[model samples]
Target: MNHYDSIVIGAGHNGLVCATYLAQGGQRVLVLEAADTPGGLAAGREFHPGFHASVAHSVNHFSAKVASDLNLAAHGFEAGADGHSIVGLGTDGAHVVAGAGALHNASDKDTAAYDEYSALLGRFAKALEPSWFRTMPRIGSLAVGDLMTFARMGLKLRLLGKKDLQEFMRVASLPARDIMDEYFEDETLKAALSWDGLIGSRMAPRSPNSAVLAMLYRMSGQAASVKELVNSLSGAATASGAEIRTGAPVKRVVINGDENGLGVGGVELASGEQITADRVISGADPQTTFLNLVGVEHFDIGFTNRIRRLRCNGLVAKLHLALDGLPEFEGLDRPGGRMIIAPSMDAIEFAFDDAKYGQCSSDPVMEVTVPSLDDDTLAPAGQHVLSAHVMYVPYELKGGWTDAARDGIRERAIDTIARYAPGIRDRILHSEFLTPADLERDYRVTGGHWHHTEFAMDQLLMMRPTYGAAQYSTPIPGLYLCSAGSHPGGDMVGAAGHNAAQEILR
Candidate 1:
């Protein structure tokens, strides 16, 4: 029988990183993944042979500090400058972006305005850097550790004083639209900035506290991002001596019925076999680990029922398209950050509003990325891989996802892309669409919440997942949570996993 020091349930970035760190500490670790491949949502799989498109992950807002500290480059990861997205506002206009150091660029005239806008983004990033060092609690509702983290983090802000607090307050506490409006006069700029505030969130542009996402996003960890971060996952995990099982499915975590409350010491797999360990780390979703697989035999109804009430609406989807040639836009040379496919900010917001009411957005919003323009690894010579990170897909639509419904979405994306790049419809050699249902089943995201749960105020910080569950520990000791479902809610910070690891080892 092969026993291990620690067994991680999922090989997602967070799980892998945690396993790596633990293994590096000299404990034998094993990463068991049900999926054939790793990198869960952050994964990059070739949609068609020789055509690679990154699904689910559309941004590298992953902290740079985390990357530098992890030394991911040593593990083999490289990125290029062109990963930026040029967000267009439906009509022929400039694109607002966050890629590269320049921030944004407009293919249209008015180079001076672009320069000024770009400079402001640089300033914003500077102001955010100091605060990045502070340890932030996981994204959901606050926990005791979160409170302690907040208190410690708050000390770093003494340099900002009261004025900084007041000025920064709007960006974190107000509606995202209002904050973007404060920064840019251009409607396109406003739309682009506001669009991100609600990414992977249940909030809208007008939702209070939605703007915090914008501030938190600029909190780049120094040098780390998507690919680099994933590379770190491999090293930290592999070097830690954790034997990673690429295709093993842990059907359930076996709870030994000891006097210590069935105290989670082992796991069972679909093969009808069990592996005993000193501890079992369920790196999967809390609900999936407890309710779906383990059943109520190991949980109290109050805790299990609360987990059931977790509100997650799988509303986001990613469309990967392979183009024979690079797309040429009307004003610009190629596709960049975001294109206002819905026509206007009103259109985009309306789509989100409809999604709120159990219906799909009529004309959804898209943050398009042309990775071939930046990274050649995605495709063959001169070919392009276009990734469209779409939002406002309803969890339960007017009519659930069907062939017709999915086709409608495809048509919408095509029409939108064509508006910016004429004849783009003809460029597609192959394409793939993943709807909410597909996302839920594939990633086991509990309603496809990439953020794990809703990002509303009620679900943020200490309130996330549950009022106190965000701390990455159950009320019981010797058990821990490590997935995005824990806290600092999402966006690949891996804080939840790191925080949990520290606690278990402490």
Candidate 2:
């Protein structure tokens, strides 16, 4: 039996980040991944001949602190420049471009309103930024460290001054629709601005409580390509003396019982090899880690139920198109930057309404990115890859995900895009459509949720993945969580992994 100080399951970016930190702290760490490569959803795969795409197409808010601490640039990952524009496509060749502190192609009133909106949100995002990197204070904890964390959080908000603090309180819980309506008039611009807040979860523009917080969470960092970020993290982890083994899926986390109750012994691989370790840190989603990997026999009834009841059925699907050449948009010279394809907030809401009943959205909305223009490696010379996040595609489709259903949604997505770029259909060399169920089966994520869990108010901060295990430490001794399902929630941010390592090392 091989033995080590810790065994980190899954080589997703977070797992690699955790392993890197632990190894740097002088612990013998081994990372095991079911996938043949690292990066989890961020792993680039060849979908068609000479064309590649990753499920997670871009990194908008990956932690700069994690990159700096791991020296990721030395390993070939540099954060892209800030202010990449987000384009809202209009059917009649009118589009709105947002970023760099300006809103172009919008009404003078809206453009002026945008500046004030940006400044207010910027201040709020800045105040809340530190909390994402730090371990959230556990509720009802009197520990000096925990208390200080709370104090610092309160102090940061108070420092925003009387009026801004009041505004933050008022706006943080408003639905994305309300916030957008308060500042913008153009429907395209409103929907485009709300995209960041509502993506990757079971949320629409009108879903209140956490959308604004989600947007602010995303506002902290610049964008980077997933391929570079993953490669860099993998390089840094291995360089720090962590051994990562791919294609090794853990069947179960071995448990042993004693007077001190149950604890992790190590893990049993699907191949039947059992390796011993002092600790086991799972990078899988909470339900998969506890209910599937660890087994329900070890957990109390209440905790098991909570894990099962987690609202994690993903509503987003990924669409990847291999184009023979760049498809020109009706209005734009080139489809540069992140483009959004929802005409209005009502369009998004109607899609969400269809999905709420377990049906695929009849009129789906999406965020489109032509990544190959910036990275030539994604496609053949002069060719391109169209990567899109198609939303309101239910994991539990009305009739379940069938070949017919998948094809229907795929065609719908293509048709929606074609409305803006008429030449897109002819340019398609191949298409890869992955529904949420496909993401679950292929990526090993529960419900195919990119965040592993829903990024809602009840499922965030101290209550994330539920109370007993919210701080990374679980009820089972020597077992910890380092996945996006932990503390600061998802999106390639790396804070969960970073915070988990700090807890383990402390």
Candidate 3:
């Protein structure tokens, strides 16, 4: 048996981040990963010959504090200049570009309101920034630190002024559809913005607090591509004295009792090797960590049920196409940037309706980006890689995900893109599509959920994963969860991992 001060399960970005912090604190740590590489969904992989794409396409809004703390930029991470914009495609070969330009079919009134809406959301997001990085305070426990956190949160709201404070609360709970309808008249703009809120979520555009989520998503840091990011974090971890082992899958968390209930001893690998450690922090999802890895026999029924109902089913499918050349979209001003394919709010709602019943949407909404346009290293000379997020893909397909069903989805996505960019099919050299089930198989993410859990009000803040383990501490001693399923609920931010390390150090 190998022994260490701490063993972190899963060497995903968060796991790496957690290990980096712990090792920086002088604790001997090891990160065990199931895959050949780290970064989990955020890591870039070769989907087709000579073309690379991140498992999850978007560069999550990373925290500057985390970046500074981990010295990411010092390790060679860089983001593209700040001119990226989203183009919303219409059926009739027309498009609306959301940048510093006029909106197609949008009135001046709608334009002014859009500005106000963005500024208001920006203020609200700024107010919420403090909470996003720190641990969520316990509901009933009033420790001095917890009370100070609450006071700071309340002060942030108070600083918004009485009128803005009242309005912020109202907007925070309002559905994206309702908020968009109230602020903008153009369906194109509304749909483009609302799609951000719906990504990775099982919720439709009409779900409450989705507007707030969209703002948060909008405010996220657009960092370097996943490959660079993973390399940077991996470098940081190793430099901080953390040992990372890839191709190592943990079979289960080892637990033992010594007159004080159950406590994690370490982890047992699937290869039957046992590594002993004083503490174990799981970077895997909550359900997988608890029920699957730890086993339900150790947990009480109520906690088991809580883990069982975590709502982590992924509703998004990642699509990557290796194109012979750069594809063209009619009426799109720029040659390369992000594109939104949801024509209207109702269209997005209809797509959600299909997924609601376990059927793939006939016209799914997507966010398409050609990374090769910005980072030429992702593809060969003159060639390109198109990455897209096809949404409303229920984890449980009505008839299950069949070859025919997957083909249908692939074709539907290509066909939809062809509507905006004629001859796009001819440009494709090869294509790769990963359904939620595929994500599960490849990433070991239960239900293929990118966030490890859905970002819902019911599963957020103190109630995240569960109130019992909200602060990263599990019911079992010496065990902790550092996955996205913990506080702050996903989307590439490593706060959960960083915060978890802080807790473990304490």
Candidate 4:
């Protein structure tokens, strides 16, 4: 018999953000979650007794900002010990942690040449970041907002007066592979940086507009992994006097419609109980929200068409492990930072083509991190958490996620690592391979897309999900979209939820 100001469906990090803000603004908010955890993709879980794993997301880009804003630290928010991923690839498997692009060719006889070459891309990121990270717009269609942002960037470059503008345009418009070719002679250096262009997408290094994907996805300030960001988000939500129920997958949302047509009424749950609210915000997928929860008949054709067209594809797989000791790469026991198991751009491209054709690569590119090497708490005493981020595995891969093939892909990816980390096989204690299917089934990622929708320029901003409807406000008033699918393109900052809550308050 209790009522509230808002009911937020889905306790994913973003949904929690929206709920916290609403509640902080004096609105009583209740967050409904289908999963048993608060962080949709950002939450951590105990993989085994005395061990936890980040199943969905592992880093927090700009998580510190969110934590500070919401006072998450005061609410028992714990910091993960390590900060960087140690990376390298190929026969040598040379390694460096942060800014690995410069160190990929660390041992190259052509060291001076490689340093100068990577410096160019570093400068490019410096120039490109401001344009891509502008404050989000107030209201507009997603396409128009992107164009406006793009044009504003163009004007800013134009003011640079011709020569600077020419270089800016070249860096902005050049294919990442093309840019890589212009700089590094070594294939591994090229492969490593080019992989950044394909993070969380279905694009290859040589793909056009892939460079922009590199620029857009990398815009987060402090968050490096999904785990860190969700930690901040979950912390913030709890601080606002809100309750989060993980593993409480809501079976259905009951609607109380007024015969007089006062724009529908409060919602009910699958338990056949009524929970009234002045507003109900859906933070799950558009398909789950409109069709599954609201019922398809409630919306007209245009709205349904737009919702149906929203792209939700999963193109990556994350595999985690606990090791008895450190994996030993050749001359890489101290493999400074992040490891990139890509030998050449062609190898990355081949994996890309395999995924596009609906098959996982027998030899896929892997980014590996052994966090316990830096932090003691992540594993049992003298043990480590081996995290591998394997990309470009299609949602509908050939041979499916049969335990055998999935294990084979796991072996291949690890074998690819063995080429770099020679004795890694000996340190193995336990392994957990999560294919795209596991991600979708566990995180409700629709098609295993870490992002609810593709981040193609067309699907950004207000055009996100639908034209003129991307800024949180839906066709039905009171409903809002605070997921990464909304705006700023899901780089693990709860910006969408944070932004949406601000709008709701206004």
Candidate 5:
């Protein structure tokens, strides 16, 4: 019988952000997290006795506005340049290093092309950046505010000038492979450049529609550790007077059916403790929120069908290795940056081809980061922790995820890494590989999608999580969505939560 102004289920970064904003707006907010700790996918966990890693090991593209608004720097949040460079590892010890607007160890033509590519994309990303944080106006809405949103978007693109605007239009929907081919001659650098576009979602270099957009989306923001980002957000939320309770699993969203139709009463805990609130904001994925927690009966047939049809099966997996010592790549003195294992666009495409058929890629491509290089606290003094985002590992394997199957993929990942770092196998003290299924179970995100759902054209912007729910407010009264499933999709970015809070406050 405890009552509050709002109840946010799941203490993911988005949820924490929404709670902080709402609390700051003078609402009595309570955030409930099923896990014993907050941070959702970004939460740090100790897989081994002395090593720590999160599903999302690195922070890229977290909202600077959100950080500044929350005064996160005061809470120990650092968002600036991700000091580490990105190195595209070559088989023959010829690596291509990408820095701000420059590429090292590439052909002269390719190097010059990279500068133009960076400048053009940088302009395009800057133009589109505001849309990511704004509430995407509902498609076909005649509301003046919605029309103004459209006008602002069009103006941003227009401000890019006729030539750049035309170029943006032409390149915006091009496949990652096509763009890379157009920009660079070095296959390794092309593959590395395209990796950002296809990293989390079910996409490859050749896959068209929104890959370039995804790349542009990630082009903004600096890198911070997941621990720092989550901790600061949690601290800010609590400091702003939002109460967060971990280990409180919501059994279901309590629904009240009156003449006005179905509405959220609050949430009932797994322990059968029902809490009351004026509104309930879900930080869980769409399917889990609707089918599992809210129940299908509360929604109409169309809404239910759309929610069910959402393509949320995650294709990415996480690999964490506890190394006895630092891993030395063939070309580099120290593995101090984000190292990409993909050799070419074809390599990425082939990996995707296998995964789309319910098989783990024989040659998996991954982005490896030795966070301990920047922060010694990740591992013991001499030891190190290696984290990688393994691509094309399907949620539903050929025969489902067996211990042998998991081990098979895990070995393949380590073997893939060992190719770049010849002595990496010898350095490994312990290894943990999490498939999409494992991610789903452990992170409480349906399909284990880091974005909660696919970031494809159909599931992005105003159409995200489906039409009626895209505005953050759900079809069900007194219920809203503040998770990655909402408009603008996912990332460590808190835009979805910030936008959701704005809508609620409005």
Candidate 6:
């Protein structure tokens, strides 16, 4: 067997980030990817003869540490100044466009409330930001580092000075609907803000803490396509002498036995090739890494059951359209950036209600962006690509996602947009639709969940994934989890990967 110091399975952004950091720490690292390319969902592809769409769209939550640590900008990762501004569409053709410093077409009350709400949330998010970069302390460990880490967190909250601290604690677990009701009266503004907490999440906006945790975690980073970002990490890893192999799907993580318990010895490829490494880190989800790759026989029943209980059913569907031309919105001069189609908080929650009973929403909430409007290289001349991250479409549909069901969901999405932007349907030259099932088939992500698991309060911080394995280390020696499933949940942030690498280096 070919041998190395460490082996990382998968080439998702987090996996690549882990490999980069490991290699930088002087470990002989090897990254094995199942796909033919490196970017995983971050890579763009052509579905039509001339039009292309990114596998994943929307870029408002990537970590700066990953970029700076990997020196991605120097390696061709361009950060566009064009940040995401939301345009909330109303049912009767009314709209509100909100940017960093301004809220267009809103009443004075809502506009002022928007500024105050954003600033207060920004402060809380900044305070919580440090926790994203570090691994959570192991449960029951009395180590000084762990004690100090916990103390620092407490001090940060205390420093919020009584009133804000009480407010933050009270609202952290409250329903998003309640928060919106208290802060703003504009239905459009409430829906726009509430959508952030439930995007790609299985939770409804009204679920307790769903709004605060989801939106706060999302606000933790900037959003952008990380194709160049991946390239930069890959380049740095290689420069540090790491080996990355595309199309090398790992069959299983190989374990060897000794007098003591078992440990990860290496990995076996689908082609029957075997490679050995001292440590094996999986950037795949816990289910994929533990049950599928490692096999349940090696673990205790308790551990296997915990992995099985992971909440990973994905509720979002992705839709892309190759437009003949840019479609005009009712009130917007431009159609790029993040545009929301949820008319009210009630509408957003009602969409989730359908999925609760295993049905696709007739009216769904969607986060939309026309990347071609900003990045012209994505489409051919005189054409544009519309990528919509649609929600409330269950992975397990009412009767399964049959051909007609797929078409039904597709039309509903397009029609929903048409209600806000007329002539959108006429401009479509081609379209590609992906249910969670399609995402799983194409990306090999378990449950087609982009974040590996739901980012609920139970699956975050010290209890993330589980209590015993929250610090990246698994029960099996030499095996660790570096996926979004581990900590900080998901959203293209590389904190989990960066923190996992830190644990291994230590």
> Model 1, range 196-249, lDDT digits (tens) per residue?
567777766777764554455543543333555565677656765677777778
Pick the lDDT winner.
Answer: 2
Error of model 2, residue 136, in angstroms: 1.7
- Model 3 residue 386 lDDT score: 91
lDDT (Cα, tens digit) per residue for candidate 2, span 387-483: 9999989999886778999999999999999999998999999999999999999999999997899999999999898988999999999999999
Q: How close is candidate 2 to the true structure, as a TM-score?
A: 0.98
TM-score of each model, in listed order: 0.88, 0.98, 0.96, 0.85, 0.98, 0.97
Clash-forming residue pairs, model 3: 61-220, 61-221
TM-score of 6: 0.97
Off by over 4 Å in 6: none
Q: Which of the two candidates, 4 or 6, achieves a greater TM-score against the reference?
A: 6
Candidate 4, 188-297: lDDT as tens digits: 76677666667677677777764554553463445344544565567667667766755455555555445433343456666666777777787887677777777766
Q: Rate residue 292 of model 5 by lDDT.
A: 98
Worst 10-residue lDDT window for candidate 4 reads: 96-105
Model 5, position 263, has a per-residue lDDT of: 77
For candidate 5, write residues 126-200 as lDDT tens digits: 999999888889889999999999999999999999999999999999999999998888999999989889888
Model 3, residue 250: C-alpha shift (Å): 0.9
Candidates sorted on lDDT, descending: 2, 5, 3, 6, 4, 1
| Tens-digit per-residue lDDT, 1-506, candidate 6 | 38888899988888988998988898889999998878677766787888877666766778887888877776676664555888888767677877665788888999888898888777778778888898887778899999888988888878877888888888888888998898888898888888777787777767875568777777766656545566676777677677999999999999999657899899999999999999999988888898889998888889888888988888888899999999888777778668899888888889999989998889988988888877777789889999998888888888788999999999999999998888899999999899998888898888889778878777889877887678998988999999888987777788888999999999
> Residue 95 lDDT in model 5?
97
The models' CA-based lDDT, in order, is 0.66, 0.92, 0.84, 0.67, 0.92, 0.84
Instruction: Tell me the tens digit of each residue's lDDT in model 3 across 76-140.
Output: 77764543566777777666676533344457887788778877877887878878777888998
Tell how far residue 482 is off in model 6, in angstroms. 0.7
Error of 3 at 162 (Å): 0.8
In angstroms, the error of model 6 at 397 is: 1.0
